[model samples]
Target: MKKGIDWRYRISNKEAMMGVVLAILNFIWWYAFAYGLGSRPVKDYTYILGFPAWFFYSCILGFIVFTILVWIMVKYFFTEVPFDVDEYKKEETE
Candidate 1:
């Protein structure tokens, strides 16, 4: 019935794409550090803060990094979307 895309749809699509991109980046970060350092022999592994280097970089530090990334994304990239269906309907009928 509508002739063009709605603003809500545009915002939703953008947010969804950003979420997917963040997930992919997080996975890549985890995979690279986990496999790159963990593939070596246990005895040859390095340590950081009493944890294996791979674990430290891939898990502990990753958690911190992604937490900050998510915060920044929400604060800057994400927008506040109204959920008032009645208001939208009223606007459409105007």
Candidate 2:
């Protein structure tokens, strides 16, 4: 018989781990812009084209790059694989 609680169909630990790694990498890249590459807060221009200078110029590039990276991760890493349930299921297939 099935147990009182079945938590299957939930994201596995591996998926969670990969997501955490992806988030960490994204944060690291953002931090690099803030510190490693020395990106300072813009205070001069109000807007470039139609958006704020900081939003249109400084962060726009990072946003594009990060978006691409995240897209790649989602496309390749976050795949739906069958979870191992041999331990939970019985040999009789009950």
Listed in order, each prediction's TM-score against the native is: 0.89, 0.47
The lDDT for every candidate, in the order shown, is 0.92, 0.63
Measured with C-alpha atoms, the lDDT of residue 7 in candidate 2 is 51
Q: After superposition, how far is residue 56 of candidate 1 from its true place, in Å?
A: 0.4
Give the per-residue lDDT of model 1 (tens digit) for 1-94.
Answer: 3666567888989999999999999999999999999999999999999999999999999999999999999999999877698877787789
Which candidate achieves the best lDDT against the true structure? 1
lDDT for each residue of candidate 2 in 19-46, tens digit (9 for 90 to 100) = 7887787677666654543445555446
Pairs clashing within candidate 2: none
lDDT of 2 at 65: 76
Off by over 4 Å in 2: 1-11, 39-58, 81-94
Instruction: In model 1, state the lDDT of residue 56.
Output: 99
Task: Give the candidate number with the greatest TM-score.
Answer: 1
